[model samples]
Structure formats: C-alpha cells, structure tokens
Target: MSVALPRIDAIRDAAARIAPHAVVTPVMRNARLDALAGAQLFFKCENLQRGGAFKFRGACNAVWSLSDDEAARGVVTHSSGNHGNALAIAASTRGIPAHVVVPEGAVKAKLEAIEQAGAVLHRCAPNTPAREAAAAEVQRQTGADLVHPYADTRVMAGQGTLVLELLNQAGDLDIIVTPVGGGGLAAGCAIAAHALDSSIQMIAAEPEGADDAAQSLAQGSRIAGITANTICDGLRTLIGESNFEALQQHGTQVVTVSDDEVVAAMKTLWRELKLVIEPSSATVFAAVLKRPEQFAGKRVGLVLTGGNVDLEALPF
Candidate 1:
C-alpha cells in the first residue's frame, strides 16, 4: 500500500489545531552570521519552542488528532530524545498517558525531561529495529496509538506548520533549510513551503556520518541499515518511508555536513546569535557555510530545530 503524505490543506489544518499549544517561535537575524555566510539569514528560533524543540509541534498535533477515546488509551513512540519529550508534554496537556520507547544511551537530559513530563519510558537497544519492536510491544500491551516519529501523516502535517509560520514571519524567502533526521521536519517543510511559494527552495541539512536522507535521495529509494556515527544524537535515525515519499514528491534537496563543521556552527550560533542550539540544529547553519555560493545574497531561512544540549557533554 502507498503511504498518504501530508498536503497543504492538512498542514493548514494542523496549524489551526496546534495553534493554541505550539509556539510561534521567533525569527532572528545576525549581521555577523550573515556576513560570514555572505547571505541574509533568518533563523527560526525553535530552540526556544516548548519542550525546547520543534518536535513539540508534531507531537502536539499527533496527540490531539486522536479521538477522545483513542487519546484515553494514550500514545506511544520511539525516539532518541526530542520526540519523546515532545510527546510526553503533548500528552500531558490532554490528560493522557504517553509511553516512549527510548534507545539505550539516549541523551540524559532528554530522558529526564520525558520522565518529568509524566511519560513511562521503555528502554531498548540503540537501533531502529529494537526501538520499533519495543514501541510495538508497548502499543500492543496498552492499546495506545503509535505515533511514528516521522512517518505518520498527522505528524508530518504538524511539522509542516513550522514552515507556514516561518513564511508568514520571514516573508519571501529564497531558501528554507531544516535538519533532516527521519525527514519529518524537512518533508513537512517541503510540503508547506512549496504550497505557499513553489519558487522557494527547500533544503535538508544532514550530518555526513548519518547521511541516509542524502543517500536515499541519490539512490531514489529509502536507504536503511547504515550505522549512524554522528555527534548529533537527535538526527541519527534513518529517514522514514513516508517522509522519503514526501521529499521525492516535493523535490527537496539534501546537503551534508561533518560533525566538526556542526560543532563549529553550533559555537558560532552561540557566540553570534546567542542561541543555545544543539548539534542537530546547527546542521542547517553548517550546510550554508559549506555551500555559500548557493545561499550567498539570498534570503535564507534556517530552522534551528532544538536547544536540548547536555551542557556537561559539550563537544567543544
């Protein structure tokens, strides 16, 4: 069976559904960073979003999309970090339970936040199959809905709302870039961005070590089973099937950057933009720096995906 992708209408509905819950995160600019990249950059500060990430938008949408009866059974999902925390928080607002199947060795701060948000945590081996199996078991046991971190259409529509807000805030961007993990955010952004203004370019910034999105796009098939070795823990997952389909449909472009470059860009954002974004979030900035010719003098919108860094484990 073919997967149904989120469309512009669905994304618009999501914007309305999640409006009361999600933040209209600020758009920031730094003259110094603009000069450094030779581009006019607008940073959508999702670092300051609720749950400290854009993951909340999708999670909130998924949680609330359920019927009251379905929500009573609650929601379950697998995540390295951000999505779990977002789901937990989103579920709480609706007075429902949340079961998160988190990988072993997932970010400590994120795990703590998930628990703090009142979600039950299930530990799994740090791999895709293991995580999915654990989440399935939880869903089977609890009769909860499985909100696949990126693949679910509702989740993708929720993620797309960010671009809707970005375009409304930043007006007439030449390019919009987002970090791609399971490709939910990028795919969603692609759908929304193209619908609003097909002239605007949509780019996915990826870690070179976990470049499955790039490889998948290049091969014209969803690539799987590559061991992710990036320091960006939030972005180590393979691209989701539905997300890949959306990307293919929208002709989204992919750009890869190294961990060293990500760290450099993270520091630059902290120093220049005063943003405490994590490694995964820094990939967009690193991509621009990596390919200045593509962005130079253009109005580039960068989605700073999250700010959930383990201060004690700073890469610098």
Candidate 2:
C-alpha cells in the first residue's frame, strides 16, 4: 500500500494549471489573535476564494487536468457542499457539464450554489457509501470522468498549491495547521511545506467527535466506521487512503478539539478578525488555543478552509 504522494513539481504544475481560475487567497493576521494565542498567527483566508472555500483549488485542478475527450464527457463527484460547488463552478469555466452527488441533508445554501453553477444534482443518503455509489452510477450512465473530492492525485496536487502560495506570502513559518476531513488539504500542505522546508511542521486540527484522523495517526493505521457527531459538518468525513498515506509519510501531527471550543474560536475570529468562517475552519485556532505550549512564540500559519456558514443558524 505504498502510495506515491504528489511531489513539489506536481504541485507547481497544478499551480500553473489553475492559476487562471483559482484565487491566490490572502494571508492575513490580527494582533489580538496573536496576543490571545501567545503566538504569531497567520491566517490563509481561503474563505474568500472562489466558490467560498479552499476546495476550489483541488476541484479546479481536477477538472482541468482531464484531456479534451474527458472534458467533453464532463466530470462527476460526491461532495457534502464546498467541493460540489467548486466542481460545478470549475466545470462551468471549461464549458462542460458537472454532476454532483450530494447527501440529502446538505446545507441548502451550498446546494443552491451548486445548482446555480449549472451542475445537475443527485441526492443520496447522507453517508459515504451511498454518496459514492450514486456518483459512480452517474459516471456509468453519463460516461463522465470521476473527480473524487480529495483522494485523487490531481486534487492533492491542487491542494498543495495553497501551501505554495501561503509559504511565499507568509515567509518562514514554524508550523502550518489545517482542519482535516478527508485529509486532502492537510496532506497537500504537508507535502508542499516539507518539500519547501523539511523543518516546517504540519499539524491537522480535527473535531473531537470526528477524531478518526488523530486516532489513526496515533495507532499507525487508518481507522474507519466511527460515527461523526461534530458541529464541524465539513470535517465529519473519514480520512482518504492516499491522504492518510501522505500524512504518515510526512509525520504530520493531529490535534482534536471539542465543538464548544470550535464555537468559541469561531466567535473570537468573527470578533477580532472580522471574518465569517465555518466551524471546520475554526478548528485550527481551536487547536492552537487548546495547546498553547505547542505553538507559543512561534509563527504559525492557519488555513481558514471555508466560510460557507448558514447565516440563519448562528452558533454564537
């Protein structure tokens, strides 16, 4: 099960491939956040990225990586929200059709955005197996290229592009933190950051209720079938196989935080940084706040994965 991880060159290629479409996304900072965390915190605001999440980077790369014939046949994938919207928008850019298999209870706003992007939506049970099966059926019928949300190498390479932009913008960072769901962003960041600077540490923040990534890393094996019961809806997925392989290869660290802690952190970011981010994005700050000693006096970079929150349901 030796998975070949995306190399720095592949990330560079992805960056070039997606440059015309993907946003570079700003790296921001707040002195108040620094004071509270006892560290210099740099936030990579992918919430402002097109389609409102860092998922666009991976989705765009995956969509555009296809050959002309593949593009003509179009793309299909299963996503809870952000990735679906991203794939839809990305496919639209190439003037191709996109098929998104979304769970029945997916956020209304996200589903609307996906449809608005002109992608046809297919609904299934809100579980991994059902989602995958529906997406596979779509591909079988439409003769579409299946673009997995996170597991594909092209998607990983696209995600790695975010690290490339972050390191360049933030300069030397001691550590980079991102919330882990399917482990796409974390794996990509780990690969790119380690390639750029071997000493740079990569850390993943996970919801305590969905701590499979943390447990898997600690036990030296992938853990599955744990029911996710966290407020961070976007992070309730089991880690992807290749993504786990990348994390293990890079020796990435994982920290778990409770839903309450995520809410508190989310509130702090909204108040201090004036940013509207989802609970999944808040996990990075929550992790730093939970373990101050780990990041004290260091320059830490946090990826605000998305801002696709339901305005009607404010956790604060």
Candidate 3:
C-alpha cells in the first residue's frame, strides 16, 4: 500500500525557505462576513500578497529549493494568472530565466503581470491537453524544470505555509476554507491544518460551472474529460491526479457557488473590506452565503487567494 502521507515537517521546511519572499499576510476579523457565515471568520487576505496572490509563497519556495544546476536550467509552467506571475517573480529574484505557457482566454491583466515579471510567455489553445502539451514543448525547448502550478510537491508544501502562518496568527481555528483549482492550495490546507489538529475541517469552495472537486468527491472516483466553463477562470480546471487521491483519502470536503454568487462576494469584499479580490477568491467567500449552518458560530478561516482582476473585465 502507499505510505500514509507526506509529512507536514517537509512543508514546514518549505515554508522556511519561502518566508523571505512571501508575506505573512494578516488574518483580519470581518464582522459583517462573520455574521453572514454565522461564524467568527478570519479572512487571510492573500489578495494583498506579493504578485497579487498566495502563489508567490509556493513559487518562491519551489524556485529557491532548486539546486544550482536546476536553477541554471531555469523554470517553466502553465497558468492563467497567479502562478505564472508568481513563478516569474520568483525566478527573477534568483536571476533565472522563466518560461510560461498560457491559454488564449487567460485574463489580459494576468498575461501582462507575467510579462511584467520578466517571463517569456507563449500562448496556447484554451484546453487542458493543449495547455499541457504547449508547456511540455516549452520545457523541452528551454530545458527548464517543469514547475507544475499545483501538482508539484514543493509547490504544495509551500502553499501549506499559509495555513501554518494563519494558525500562528490565530490559534484553534475550527475550520479552514479555500478555493480549489488544481488542489495545490487545498492539498496544502489539508496537510497544514490536519497536521496541527486532525479535527480541523478543511473545506474547498469552487464555482458551480467548474465543480470537478464536488463531482469527484461525490462519485468516489477520479473524473476526467469534463470541460471547465466558469467565469472564475482561475478555478476553471480539474484537480491533479495525486491531489484527487489526497482529497479522497483525507476526507476533505468540497462546496460550490455560482458565478453570480462569486460576483456578489467580490462586491461585498470590495465594498465592506475595501479589498479588490478576483472572482476565484470570492468562491470561498461565497461559500458562507450558501452553507451558513456549517460554519455558524465556528472559528472559520477563508483564504482570499488573489487580486488580479482587470477592472475592464468585470462582468458587471
């Protein structure tokens, strides 16, 4: 049988490697949001993080953990927004070249951010297979290490650092909730939260249009061939193979919200908290709106993943 699971100690080490580049973002108590969720909600405002998302934590760690030979080869990956810019920034800090493959429909602001961070960007057809194939080709061309946006162990471990910091900021949280795309952050959350307290309920919030995690959890099997059709472009993908296995084995829960609900949450965070979060980050924020009972009166944690919204691209 496979081993129990990766140790949180490894993730903690990754956190140490990335702390210099990543910010220890504040965990703000939002009374209005807490009242809506019927719980004491601590919003981890990663929207204010460097490179405009929590991906910076993982990207920085992954890049820094590279050996000198690997660093000389540089790094590469495919991402719609946060991860691409994050890797670009991380590689820039190390004076290493970075190559990023992006889908055609990727948000313009994200594309600009990646370019602004000094990464060479290559456009690909907007599909899972094409994106992966394009990224693979870039790696072959550049000999860069393929730093998968979500599936890499180093990246997942680095993402776990967020929860560790959150736990340090606020002790004894009842639950931790975050938006799940390919499961990097969710995997990190599961590893970090449960390692600290096996009782901490880690919930992943997703958009209904691309609710692969929800469907997979219910079906009890890995599901592929499903197309992502969500306005939350950051969440428009299925979980990674190992990520699905981890989620199922760990009993991680998944919740979903509509695109409209995400939009409403975005507006709420902006209006009430004055934070300009993206549609994907709002997915977890919208979770409380849908399932008020589950989080009611609990010390709940919400990871606001990013703030890379292009004002002109707002659906309103």
Candidate 4:
C-alpha cells in the first residue's frame, strides 16, 4: 500500500473543523526578545491552547473525524503525556471512550490531566515497543481506532492547521520554526507553509540528545539509533516515516539544540514574554539563538508547541 501524506487542502479543512474547539492562540512579540535574537519574532502561543498544548488540535481532529461507528467504538493511542491528555479530552467532548497507553514514568501533571479528562490509562515500559504493544492490546480489546501520535494522516493534517492559522495571524514571515519530536507538527507546518508561500523557509528545532529528525534528513532516510536523553521530554521520539518523508520533500532544515540551551530559552520566554513554556517548546527559541545571523532583521515565526511542565520539577 502507498502512503497517504497530509495535504494543504486537508489542513485548511482541519482548521475549519477544529475552529470551534481549539483556540486561535495569540501571536505574541517582545522587544527584548527581538533585541536579543536580532529578529522580529512572532510567537504562536499554543501554550494557551486547550489542554495547554497544540496537541489538542490534532487529537480533536482525529477524534471528531471518525465516523459515527468509529466514534462509538472510541479511540486509543500511546503518548508520553500531552497527546494522551488531548485525546482523552477530545473523546470526552464527543462523549466517546478513550484509552491511552502511557509510559510508567510520564510527567505527573500530564498523567493527572489525562486521567482527569476521563481516559482509561494503561501503563507500559518507557520504550516505543512497549507503548505500541500496550496500545495495540487496548485497541484489540476495546475496538477503538489507533491514533498513533505523530504517524496518523488525520493527526498530521490536523497539526498543519496551526501553521495555517499562524501564517494568517503573523503577517509575512521570512522563516517559520517549530520543535520536532515525532515530526507531526514540523511536517504539518512545512506542508502548510510551503503551500501558502514557497518562499517561506521551514526549520525544525530538535534536542541534541534526540536528533533523529536531523540525522534522518541528512542521510536521506530514517535513522533510529539515538536513545533519547533530553530534558525536552516532548521531543524525545524518532520521527515517523511519513513525517520524515514530508520534511524531506518540503526541504526543511533541522537544528539541534542542547538541553542547556533549551532551558535557557525557556527562562527567556518566561522573563521576556511572561509565558510559561516547556523545554520542547523552548527548542525553537534555542534554534533562533543558535544562529542569530540567519534570523537577523527577518520576521521569524515560532510555534510555542506546549506548556505542560511540572511546577515542582522546574529545570530553571
């Protein structure tokens, strides 16, 4: 079977479909940040979105896109945190059951949020294989559709909608950057950005510890040897196959930032913009800072992917 990647039209449709549910999150700017980065930055604040993350957009789209029978059967997926919570909340909105397989040591606050949204949680080992097995078992038992966090077409299309909204909201941007984990959001952003304006360059920020997307893009194929040991918890996964293909086709650039750099960016975001963002979200800022010459005097748009950080486990 051939792959069915996300398309621009589908992304536009996703924007329309999820409009009522997901926030049209504000685009913020700070003079201090501009001076620091030497770029006019537009921050798409998905941190303020429902579930406190952009994951809600894709999860909502997937849950709602289901046929009546599928929705009735409900949805199942595996996630470290945000996506699971988003899926649980999305299913709750449609009055459908949701089963989430989460790793044993997932974030406390996020796991609590998932449970609070009424999802039945299944615990597994913190590896991809374990999570997949647990989710498959849940789907087998419950007859729920498996909505792989970053690999599903519906999810990728839904993720593209954020860039669609950002381009409309942020005016003319010379560059757009977002953190890449499993590559759903980055791939989606690349598709939408390239479709809207081929001139706009796409960049994906990744943790140095989990630089699979960067390595994959360099090798012209997927590379999966890197064991994730990043503080950017949300960006520790290997890029999905479709996501890698999308990035390769769209000509996206991947920049790797150290965990320390991510932490510094997180602090700057809090101090300069008064926004509480997680380390994964901070990767974009780190990217810009990593290469100030590339972004200088340009209108750069950054997607603040999520803000689901544990207060007690503060890195700064």
Candidate 5:
C-alpha cells in the first residue's frame, strides 16, 4: 500500500508563513564534536526556540493559517507537554482561546508554560485512548478545531520546515538524525532532507523505553502497546499511522538509545557545548555517539529538538 506524504512545497510555504513567529534557530557546528564522533556535526538548535521547543514552529504556522472563522472556534490539542505550550502561545498571539488536554504525569513546568500562555488546561489519563477521549470531550464543549501534536498534516509540514532551515544554513548533509515520539519531527526531517538531497540518510533516534519507532521500522508495521517509560518524555509516543507511512516510504533509519546514554549525551552537551538540552533532544546526540560507525566521516545534521528542562530541579 502506498502512503501519501506531506508536500514539500506546502512545508516550504509554512516556513515562509511562520518566519516571524518561529525563531530561525542557529546551526551550531563544532569541529571538536566532528573529530570526536568522526563526522561533521551540525546541530539545529530548536532547543533554543520560543516555548523552548520546535513545537512552536508548527503551532505558530497552524494557528496563523487558520481562517478567521475557523480560528474563531479556537484550537485544542492533546499533548504531554511541549505542544500544549506551543499551541497556547500561538493561540495567544492570534487572540484566540486555546484548550489543551495534557496527561496527569506531564511535567509541572510544561503545564505552567501552557497556563502562562493563556490556555485552559484539561488533565487526562496518561494513555493514548484516555488522551483522545479527553481531547474529544474538550472539542465537543469548546467547538475547537483539534490540532494534533503529530498526526496533522499541517503540523507535520510546519515541522518539516526545520530541516529546510538546517539545509539552507548548513548545507550538504550526508545524514540527518532526529528524536522521534509520535514521529512528527522525524517525518518532517525525512521529507525535508530527502527533498533537499535525495540520497541524504534521514534517521530517527528514540530512547529504549520508547523505542516503538525502531520496532515499527523493523516489523514493517505500526507497533502498538509501547509504554512511555523513558526520561525522554517528549519521545514517549508511538509512531502515528501517517508518520509510519512517511517513514516506511522514505526508508528512514531508526535507532534506539538507552536512558543512561541519553543522560550521558545531555551531560556532554552541557559540559562540552555549554548547551542545556532536554533528554529527548539528547537522544539523537546519543545515537550519533553510540553508533559512530554509521555516521563516521559523513556530514551529519542532528536536530536538537528542545531545551525545556527544570533547571531548578535537575537529576544529577
């Protein structure tokens, strides 16, 4: 069965529309990281973006592009954390109400970020079904358009713009690696990278506890029943049906890393690069470190997905 992928031109259009709201975050390249890892490393620091994650780019694009009539109904989403915050901020910018359904176990800091952006918070069970149910109820009550965190094509294309920016700024990447949860970012990466350079390897990295991306790739089917058991909370989602289609079609590389490895990479970034990256973002860095052979001597781009962390309370 052939699957339809989001159009690269639509993604490019989204990049243009969201240019102001979305930060054109820097591409930080290090000869040292390149030497140590045996590859030229260009890090797309979406970690430093507004709302502390790349979710802002998609949320901004989706929110702004909504018709005045459509936006009048407002927007709602089910997010563990970052997407909720991004949507809230985006809605706030458009002078529209945002209703966010988040899991009970979602980080308090993230919840506060959403609330701070003037969105009403609705809490739900931590599972997929429960989250869908809660979001459905919110949509029924608020008449809000459901802007999904990953599954929405607009959101995926918006996220795809990150790779476009990376390629424009850094250029000529042999491989592109990103952390995958619901696969929004990875699918976006694959579409953009492949469009930019058909032969460029697009890779997805996930924490072992949330390694469904890898399993789904290996099994040649969507893997259900994966538990969210990693410190990379942002990567705790199973790949969505559409995301799987993109990955399968693109033949994207999938890699898994341990929580310990994620932590080590996080520490390395903080210590070596002076960047405070989140666990999910570090998953990609860890993948590169763990499997240097795959990337050695190649020009690699690693999307550092976010930097949202509780600095006041960090795990030593």
Candidate 6:
C-alpha cells in the first residue's frame, strides 16, 4: 500500500504555524570547515533552536495542530531525549499536559530538561517496546493525542519547515545533508528540498553502529535487528515505516560514518565554528568528510541538528 507523504502545502502551512514561536535559525559558514571538506558549507544552526534541537519545530507544530478539545486532553510521546523535551515545551506553551516515556539511562541533562519543561516523565527499559508501552499507557489514562516522534504526518510536516527555511536562506545549494535516526528530518528535508529545487541532492547521514536507514534503502524495505552502540544517543532509534517509505520515494541517499568520525566532526564544529552540537548533529559533516570528492566545489547545506550535549560528558 502506498502511504501519504507530507506535501509542500502542508510544509508551507507548518512553516506559517511555527513562525511565531520557532526561531529562524541562522545559516553559518566556516572557512576552516569549507577548506577541510573541499566544499562551501552552509550550516543551519538548529542547535540554537528553542529546545536546543530541530525537534522543537515538529513537536511545536504537532502540539498546535490539535483542536481545542484535543489540546485540553493533553499530548504524549516516546523519546530518547530531545524530542521529549521539545514536546514538553510545546505542550507547556499550549497550556496542556505532556507525558513523555523516556528510556532508562538516557542522558541525565535531557531528562532533567524534559521535567523542567513541565512534562510528566515515565521511565521504561532502554528499548522500543518498553517506550511504546509506556506512551500507550499515558495516552489511555489521559485521552491525549499521541504525538509520535517522526511517524505522524503533522510531525513530518513540521520538520519539513527546517529545509524550507534553509533553502531560502542558503541561496543555491547543490546538496543538503541531515542526520537520520527515525528518518523524520531526512524524509521532511527530502520533500522540501526536492520541491523547491529538484536538482538538489538530499543525503541522509547515519552512524555506522546504527545504519538501518542505509541497510533499508539497500534492501528495498525496512530492516531492524541491528544493535546500536554509538555516542550519538539521539540517533539510535529504528526508522519508522512511514519515514522509510518517504525516503525511498524521495530518492534520498543514505551514508554511514564511524562513531569516531562523528566525534571528530563534533569537535571540529566546536573548535572551528565555535558551535556546540551533539554527536548526532555532527553525522552530516562526518558523511561529507567521508566523501569529499562527491561534494567537491559544491555549495552544501548541513543541518546542525542539536546542541543538547551534557558538558561533563565529552565523547573525545
């Protein structure tokens, strides 16, 4: 069966819905980075976003898209960290209850941030099944709308807004790279980038430890069973079916980089651009650095996905 994907109109509407609240995150360039990669790089600074990640765009859009009665009932979701915090903040902004099902041993800083944002937290085993069960329980108890991370149409539409803003701000760009975990950002980006400029290449960066997106694309179907063992905590999840379908239809190429490469790229961003970003965010640069010849002399846009790293826990 063919799945319905987020359209350009939906993305445009999402942009309008989120503009009042979401920051039009800046596009940055670094001479050192450009020289190192042999391409002119444009980094969309989403680390400076409201919840310190591009996740806020989708979370906020989902929260606001709900009807008055639905909002009154509240919202629920499962996340490793960033998405939960974003949804919590979004729910708080709309004055609704937010319930987040978080895996045990998730980054302490992120869990703390979710609580601070006024979301009721439920702890579960550090796996998909437990997280989903907890979220289902919350939804049953509260009759809240289930704002799935990357699976729902509204969240995908919300994420597309990032590339919409990036395309307009970065001028003509030959390539756009984004870290792919649940595939929301990658799928959303593919839609927006292709619609605006069909010639632009959309690339999905995945950690070698968690390369389901790459394997799925290769196998012509979604693949699960790979054990994730990377420092990129935000990117360890399996891609949702809807998101996988979107990637396939949009012709997004997936590339895998080593965890060491991800860490190196993270340090580079911090030193060269003076920007603090999480390991997941650095995957985009890791992909580019891994294949400089592919992007040589081109204007490449990289989405700096988040900056929610715990200061004490340096991967390097």
Quality of model 1 by C-alpha lDDT: 0.92
TM-score per model over all chains: 0.98, 0.98, 0.97, 0.98, 0.97, 0.98
| Candidate 1 residue 20 C-alpha distance from true site, Å | 1.1
Each candidate: how many clashes?
A: 0, 0, 1, 0, 0, 0
Worst 10-residue lDDT window for candidate 1 reads 1-10
Worst 10 residues of 3 by lDDT: 1-10
**Candidate no. 3 TM-score:** 0.97
In candidate 5, which residue pairs get closer than 3 Å at backbone N, Cα or C atoms, i.e. clash? none
Candidate 1 Cα misplacement greater than 4 A, ranges: none
Per-residue lDDT tens digits for candidate 2, residues 183-285, read 8899888999999999998999999999999999989999866799999989988999889988899889999999999999999999998988999999999
- Give, for candidate 5, the lowest lDDT window spanning 10 residues: 1-10
Better candidate by lDDT, 1 or 5 = 1
* lDDT tens per residue, model 4, 1-316: 1146888988888888888788999999899999999989999999999999999989999988999999999999999999999999889989999999999889999999999999999999999999999998988898999888999888888889988889889888999999999988988889989999999989999999999998888888898657999999998888888888988888899999999999999999999999889999999999999999899999999999999999999996
Q: Which segments of model 6 are wrong by more than 4 Å? A: 1-3
- What lDDT tens digits, residue by residue, belong to model 1 across residues 1-316? 1357888999999999999888899999999999999999999999899999999999999998999999999999999999999999999999999999999899899999999999999999999889888998998899999998888888889989999888889889999999999888998999999999999888999999999999999999987657899999989988888888887888889999999999999999999988799999999999999999999899999999999988899999
lDDT tens digits, residue span 240-315, model 3: 8777777876688899899999988889988888888899999987997888888878898889999998889797
Which residues of candidate 4, in runs, are more than 4 Å off? 1-3
Q: Roughly what TM-score does model 2 have, to 2 decimal places?
A: 0.98
Return the TM-score for candidate 4, rounded to 2 decimals: 0.98
Relative to the unseen true structure, what is the C-alpha lDDT of residue 60 in candidate 2, on a scale of 0 to 100?
A: 93
What lDDT does each candidate get?
Answer: 0.92, 0.92, 0.87, 0.91, 0.88, 0.92
Model 5 TM-score, all chains together: 0.97
